[model samples]
Target chain A: MILVNENTRVVVQGITGREGGFHAERCMAYGTQIVAGVTPGRGGTLWQDKVPVFDTMEQAVRETGANCSLIFVPAPFATDAILEAVDAGIGVIACITEGIPVQESVKVYSYLKDKRVHLIGPNCPGLISPGARCKVGIMPGDIHRPGTIGVVSRSGTLTYEAVAQLTEAGLGQSTCVGIGGDPVTGTDFVDILKLFNKDPDTEGVVLIGEIGGAKEQEAARYIKRSFKKPVVALVVGATAPPGKRMGHAGAIITGVSGRAEEKIRALREAGATIVPSPGEIGVTMKRALRR
Target chain B: MKIHEHQAKAIFARYGIPVPEGGVASTPQEAREIAQRLGGRVVVKAQVHAGGRGRAGGIKVVDSPEAAQQAAVALLGKHLVTHQTGPEGVPVSKVLVEQVVPVERELYLAIVVDGSGKAPVIIGSEAGGMDIEEVAAIHPEKILQVRVDPIIGFQPYMGRDLAYAMHLPSAVVRNAATIIGNLHRVFIDEDATLAEINPLVLTPDGKLLALDGKLNLDDDAFFRHPTHQQLQDPEQEDPLEVEAGKYDISYVKLDGDVGCMVNGAGLAMATLDVINAAHAQPANFLDIGGGGDEAKVAQAFRLVVADPKVKRVFINVFGGILRCDVAARGIVQAYGELKTPMPIVVRMRGTNAEEGRQILNDSGIPVRLVADLKEAIAQLQQVGRR
Candidate 1:
C-alpha cells in the first residue's frame, strides 16, 4: 500500500531514450504494468509494439490513466519532465535521472509542496514492493523476496548489498525504496517511514544511510518519537574525508553537521540498531528483528 | 565551478550589492596601475580557488602603489598553498586590486540549499570575518537561518527576520534586509549552488560592502546557461578527474596501491571501506555508474592503469542496469591494449554473472574473478603481496 503495488499503472517518460526504453522493458519483465510512454517528438508510435507511446504526458495520462510516472529523461531536461508528470496528475513519480542540477531540483521540490504527489528521486534507483511483485526504476528485481521488513536507503548498490544479505538470512522485504543520495531529493526518510509505519506487511525496517546531509539525523528523531517498528541502520563513508563529495552529490560532509559519527550517535540515542559496517548489516538486522 | 573572488564580486556588483571598487590584474604592473587608479591605500589579494588566503599571506594591504606591486610580485607566478589547498599548491595567475574599507563590524551572509530541508536557506551570523563553521559549532545561536519558500520567493519579511536575528542596528536594518534579499536573488538568478559573502562589513560611515565573495554555480545546470560553461578552469583540476568526467564517470585519485573501479558511489565508498578494513588503502575512487557500456568500462580501466602508484586493480561491479558481461569485455579490451603487468581482480554479481566470469576466464588475461566484496578485498591483499 506504500508507494507502489501490483496494480500500479505506470507511464515511462522519455521512452525513446536508451535508459527509458531499456528500463521500461525491465519493469515490464518484473511484473509492473507500464500502461503508456511519452516522448515529445515520437507520438503515435508503439514502444516495442506493446505500450502505447504519446507525444506528451497529458496525452498519455488521458489515454491510459497512469497514476505513476517513471522518469528516465536526461539530467538537463529532467526538471521539465518531472513538472510535466506533476502537471498531468501523477500521484507517484520516481525519477531515475541522475545529475539533475541542484537549482532545478530546488524548484521541483518547492513545486511539489502544494501538490498531492510523492516524488522519489532525481538520482535514485527507485522502489520495489516484493510482495506485490511491483518494481519501478532501476533496481535489479531478482534479489528481492516478499517478506516482513521494509528498506529505505540513500544509495543504489548498497541497497542491493543489504537486501541480498537479508534474503540470505531468509528475510524478505515488504518494499525497498532508494530515496537518492542527491542533496535535494523528492521523498525523504520520514515520508517513507510514515508510509511503512502504516503498512501492515512491514514488520521491521532497515535504513541504509551514508555520510553527508542531515536527512538521517532527522529520520532518527522521527523514529524515536513516532515509529514503533524495530529498526536497524548502516551508514557508509564513515572514513570519508571532509569537503569531498563521495560519489553522490549529497554524500559530502560540508561542516561538522553531516558527519557519520553524528548520525550514528543520533540513531543510537533513538534506539535504532546500528550496524557497525556494511558487511555486518545482515547479522545486525536479524538481531534487531528478534528484539 | 567555483569562481574566483573577483568574478564573484563582479556578479554581486551586478545584483546591486555594494562591493569594493576592484579590478583583476594578471601582472604586477597591472596590479600597481589598478591600485594607483583606486588610490594609494589598497589591498592586493591572490586570486586562487582555495580559501584561507589571508593566513597564507596570499592577501596583503598596501599603503602605496609600489607596495601593491611588491605584493603582487610576491604572490603572482608563485604557488599559493593554504590549509584548504593540498600539498601541491595551486599557482596564482592573477590578483585582485581594490581599495580598503573602514570596517565597523564584519557580518556573515550567504544563501545555500539546505539539503535536508530541500529548500534554499539564508545563513547569516553576527560573528563574521572568522570561520562560519567554527562559529556554527561553538555558538549555533549566533547563526540566523531562514528557509525560503520558492513559491512566495525570498520575501522581504524573511530578510527582516534574518536582520533582526543578527541584531543589526535599526539604521542598517533595511540595508541589511535588502542585501540579504539581493544575495538570495543572486543565488537563484545565477543558478548557484552557493553564494556567500564572508565579511559583509558595515563601514564607520554607515555603508555596507561585500568584502569577500564566493559563488559556485551548478555544473549540471550548464546547459541552461551556456556562457557559464566557459568559467570552468581545467588547469586547476586533477588531470585524471577531468579526463574521467568526459566519459561521465566519477574518479578521485588517492595515494594507495590498489585501484578500485565500482558501479555506484555508495558501493564505491563501501569498496574503499572494505579495502581499508582489509588493511589496504585504495588507489582511487572510480564509479562507472549504472550506465556503463563497454567503452565506458574500457575507459575507466585505462584511467585506473594510468596511475603509476596503482600496482593492482580491483573491479567490483553489481550488474543491475549495467550488465556484467559488458564490464568483462571492457576489462579484457583494456588489458589487451595496455598490456600492463599489474594484477587485476574482478568481482562480478547479478545480471549474467556467469557469462561475465566465463569471458574473463577465456580472455586468458590472468584476471582473477572473485564472487563478492570480501573475496575481492582478500584477492586485492593477496595480489598486493605478490
Candidate 2:
C-alpha cells in the first residue's frame, strides 16, 4: 500500500535557499526524480543541479508535473509554503524547516487535514522509504538499508539514533519518518505507526518519544487496539523531575497522564517493548521482533 | 547566560532600580581611586557571576580606600569559590567598589520565566540573602508570586500587592513598587530568563535599594541585543561547550562514559537519562542539532574522542530531518581524521539509514549499529563489549 513510487516527481520550495539547495542537491544525488524548485521572484532561475525553478508552487507543479514537494523554507515562511504546496495539489509535502512558531504549525496542521494530502514535519527531518532510492529533508541517507523495522519519531536526532541502533544490529528499516517536534505536526506518532503496521516491508517498528506531549500515550493506545506488528518504545526525560521539566511540543508530561512513568506504564500494558535508554533501542527492537 | 554582578547592577540602574553607587575596576589602583572618590566605608566585591560570594571570601568590607585597593589586589584575576558556582572557582575579572549603606532590613525579589503554564512569575520574599531553594523548603509562605498576564505583563498594583505581602514598611513599599516596575521593564525589554535582586536593602535613611543582582538573558534572543552580550564572562562557561555552540550543537559537559550525539534538545536530555539508568554517565550532551553536516559532526566526534573519560561513543540518530547515511559519512570522515581507538556504538533510524551504515562500514571503522535502544545502551555501558 506504499502508493508512492521511486519515479514520483518532486519539487522543492525555497529551492535556491541554503537548506533547500542542500537537500535538493542531496535528493538529486540520491536519484530522487526531482523536477522543479519554487522560490518567489526567482522564477526561471536554476540551481546548479539544473532543476527548473518557479516563482510559485502552483507553477512548479503545473510546469514540472511534480507530485511530491520538498519544502526547505525558513520557519517564518513555513506555513505559507505548506499551504501553497497543499493548494497546488502537490500530493505529498515535507517541510524540513526547524523553529516554525507553534501558532504557524497549528494553522498549517488544520489546513492539511481538510485536503487529500500527507504532510510531514514543519520541524522534521523528512521521510525516506529505503531501497526505493529517494531522499528528502536533511537526513543523511547512506546509513539506511532495506529491512523489517520502520521508525516514526517526533524527534529528528533521536529518530536517527534509534534507526542507527537498529541498523547496527543488522536490523534494516522499511521506512523512517521524523514527524517533527512541533506541537502540531502533519502526521502524529499513531498515524505513522498505522502506516508502518500496514507496510509489509516493516515487520517491526521503533518509536523514540520525548516528554511534554501526549502523542506517546495516544500511540500506545492505538497500538493496543490496532497494531499487529511488534513495537519498541523509548520515552526520554525520565529522570527529569516535575519541578520545571517539560518535553517537546507533543510531549505530554506533568498534568498526570503525560508523565514518563505513566507513558512507560501504558506502553508496557499495551504489549509494546519499552527500552529505558536510547542506546538499548536497537536491542529492544530486535527482541520485540523475535517476540 | 549569566551576567556578572557589576553588569547586573548596571542594567538595574538603567531601569531605574536603586543599586549602591559603584564603579568597576580591573586593577587595585583603579579600585582604590574609585573607593577614594566614594569617600566612605565600601564593599569590595569580586565581580564573578555567582551567588553566595560573601561565604567564599569573595566579598570584603573595607574601612578605607587603602583597604579596598589591597582587597582588589588579592581578588582580581584570582578564582573565587562559591557554593552556587560549583566546586570550580569563578575567575574574578573586575572588582566592584561601592559605597556601603547601613541595612535596616533585607528582602528578596526575582522575576523568572516559570516554565509552568508558560507564564512569567514574580517571586518575592521578606527574608533575603539566602538560597531561594532553602527559602522554598523552610518558609514557603513568606514567598509571594503574582503570575502576570502575558499580554499586559506585571501591573504596578500587582507589584504593590507582592511588596505588601512581603511585609514592607510604607516607605520601603513605595520603593518596592518602582523596583518591581523596573524589574518588569527589564524582563520585557531584554527577554531575560531570570532577573533577581537579592537583599534589596532598606537603608538607615529608610530608602530601598537593590543591593545585589543577577540577570540571565535568553541566548536565543541574543541576536536582538548585541550590546548586552558584552557582559558575558567566558571564564565561567566550559570552553568545550562554548566551542560546541559555535557549531550550533548544544553540548553540555557532564561526567559520564558515552559521548552522546543526538539532534533535538528534548531527545538529547532523554539520551543522558538512559545512559545513567544503564549505570553509565553520559560524558557530554552533544546535540549535533539539525544541520548534521560533516564538519559539525566531525568537530563533535573529535571533542568526544579526545576525552579520556569517554570510553565509548554512542551515536543514536533517528533520521527524520537528518539522514543516517550523511551522519555515517560524517562519522566515517571524522574517524579517519581523528584516527581514534575509541569504540563507537552506532544506532541509526529514519530515512536513508542503510546508505549511512554502508558508509560507516565501508570506511573501515569498526562502528556497530544496534537495532534497539536498550541493547545499544547496554553495549555503550561496556565500551569494549563485542
Candidate 3:
C-alpha cells in the first residue's frame, strides 16, 4: 500500500530546467514511467521528443492521468510548483528542490493537511522502490536492488551509503526514502515508518536519522507501540559541535534535545538496535533480523 | 544567518515591538556618548551571536557614562567566552548601548519554524529570565506553543490565547497581543527562522518591553530580503567557513589529522563518525554539496589542504546526481596544481564509480581508492598509523 510502485505514473514539474531535464531523463532510463511534463510558458513543447510538456499541472494531469509528481524546480519557484501539483490533485508529490524558504514550506504543508496528497521533500533525494523498479527524485539508480529491508533517511548521499553497504551485505531493499534535511520538510520518519509497516514485502526497516528536531523521537514511540518489524537505526553528527549546521538545515544541535546521543537513547529504548557507526549499519541490520 | 541582538532589536522596533532605545557603537567614547544620550542609567551589551552574555561579563548595567565607557573598554577588545561560544570565544568589536528598563517580571517569547509541525510556532513562557531550554526542562508547564496557519497568517485568536495563557493583566493584555502579532509579522516579513524575545519584561510601570531580542533570518530567503542579508558578519565566523559558504560548500574546522570532503552532509558526518570509530579523528567537515563541479571540487581541496593539522585527506563522494567521474576530474586537477603529496584515500561510489576510479588510478597520484565505506575507514586508520 506504499504510494510508489511499478504502476505509479509520474509527471515531471519544471522539466525544461537543467537539473529537472537531466534527472527526468535519468529516471526514465531507470525504467520509471514518465507520462507528462509541466513548465509554465513552455507548453506544447515535447521534452526529449517523448514526454509532452504542458503549461500547468491541471492540463498535465487531465491529459495523462498522472498520479505522482517529481518536482525539480528552483528554490524560489518550488513552493508554487508544489502547491500547483497539490491543486491539480496529484496523489504523491516528491519535491527534489533544495533551499526552499521555510515559510513557503509552512504554507504548502498547511494546505496539504486537508488534501489527500502525500508530499515527500522540499529539500530531499526522494524515494526509490527497487523491487518494483520505481525511482523518484535523485538517488543513484544502480546502487539499489530488489529485496526486503526497507530504508528511510534524512540525507541523500548517506542514504546511498546505506544502500551500497546493504547491497554489499547481500541484503537488498524494498524502498528507500530520503525525507529531506531542511528544517521544514513534507515527509518525516513517522509517515514513512507507517508506510513501511504496512508494506507486506518489507520484512525489516533501517532508520538512518541525524541530529536536529524531535521527529526521530516521535518515530521511536510509534515503533514501540505499533511497528513490529525489526529496525536497525543509525544517527549521525555524534561529534558535531553545537549550533553548527552540518550541511542539512535540520542537522544542527540546538542545546541538549537535538543531540545524537539523545536520539540514540530513544531509539534503543524503543527496541530498535542503534548502530553507532555507519560501517556497522548493514552488519547490524543483518544481526537484528538474525538472517 | 544569525543577526546580532542589536540588529534583531532594530528589526523588532520597526515592527512596532517595544524595545529600549539603543545604538551600536564601535568605540568606547561612542558608547559613552550613546549611553549619556539615553539618560543616566544605561546598559552596555556586547554584540555577539552567542548567548549567556550577562554571565560571561559581556553585559553591564552602569549608572553613569564613565561606567559605560569602562564596560565598553573592557569588553570591546576582548574575546567573550560564553557557554554557547564553545572554548574559542568570539571577538567583540562593537557594543549596543541602551537605556535600562526596570522589571517587575521576566517572561519569554519566541517565534520559530516548528520543523515537525511544518509550520510557524509562537512559544511563550511566564518563567523567562533564564534560558528557555532550562525553563523547558525544569518547568515545561509554564511554556506554551501555538502553531500558526501560514495561509491565514497569525490570527488574533492565537495572540489572545497566548495573552490569556501567560496571564497578562487587563491593562497590558492588548499590548501583549499586539507584540505577539507584530513579532509574527516580523517573522514572516523578514523571512526569519527564529525571532525571540527572551525576558519580554513587564516593567514596574505596567508596560511590556522586549528586553532581549534574537532573530535568525533564513539563508534561503536572503534573496527576498537584501537588508537582512547585509546583517551577516563574516568576521564572526571562521575565515575558511565563510569562504566555503560563498561557493555553496559547507566547511567546519575540527582538530584532527584526516581532512574529509564528502558529497552530502549526512554522509560527511557519517564519514567523520566512521573515521572516529576507526580510532582517527577528522580534521574538518567539508561538504561540496551534491552537485559539486570541478571548480568547487578544486576549491574544496585547496581549503582542506590549507589547514596545517590535516595530514591525510579522505575524499568520499557518492556519485548520485554528481557523477563520480566529475569528482575524479576535480581531484586530479587539484592534486596536479597543488602538488601536495598527501596520501589521499578516495572512496567513489554510486554512478560512474568505475570511470571515476579509472581517472584517479591513471592520475598516478598517491591515492588509495576503496570500494566500501568500511574499507575506506580502515584504510584511513592504517594511514594514520603510518
Steric overlap count per candidate: 0, 72, 0
Over A1-291, each residue of candidate 3 has an lDDT whose tens digit, in order, gives 267899999999988999988889888998999999999999998999999999999999999999999999888888899989999999999999888888888888888987788899878898898888899888888889899999999988999889888998899999999998988788889989999999998999999999898888989999999998999999999988888899888888885769999988999999999986787788999898994
Candidates' interface RMSDs, in order? 1.4, 5.9, 1.2
Q: Candidate 2 on A1-291: residue-level lDDT in tens?
A: 242458678998888887788778888787688889889999987778477889998898889889998888776677788899999998878888775644345446555676889898777878877768776666677777777788887776667667667778899888788887765577778778877777777788888777665777788899999999888888877654342222243443434555677778888899888885666788888777776
Those runs of model 3 whose alpha carbons end farther than 4 Å from true positions after fitting are: B337-340
Models ranked on lDDT: 3, 1, 2
Tens-digit lDDT string for candidate 1 (A205-260): 99988889898999999999999899998877776777777789898888776898
Please write out the lDDT profile of model 2 over residues B1-386, one tens digit for every residue. Answer: 67888888888898999899989999999999999999958999998876778999999999999999999999998988887564667789888999998898889999865433235678899988887778877998988888865555668898899888988887677778878988988977886767899988888888888889988775545556788678777877767766775776666666666777876766677767867777777887667776566677788777767666777888876665566777787788778876556688887766777788888878888777776556776677677454
What docking class should model 2 receive?
Answer: incorrect
Model 1 docking tier (incorrect/acceptable/medium/high): medium
Q: Each prediction's Cα lDDT score?
A: 0.89, 0.76, 0.89
Interface RMSD computed for candidate 2 is what?
5.9
Q: Is candidate 2 or 3 superior in TM-score? A: 3
- What residue pairs clash in candidate 1, if any at all? none
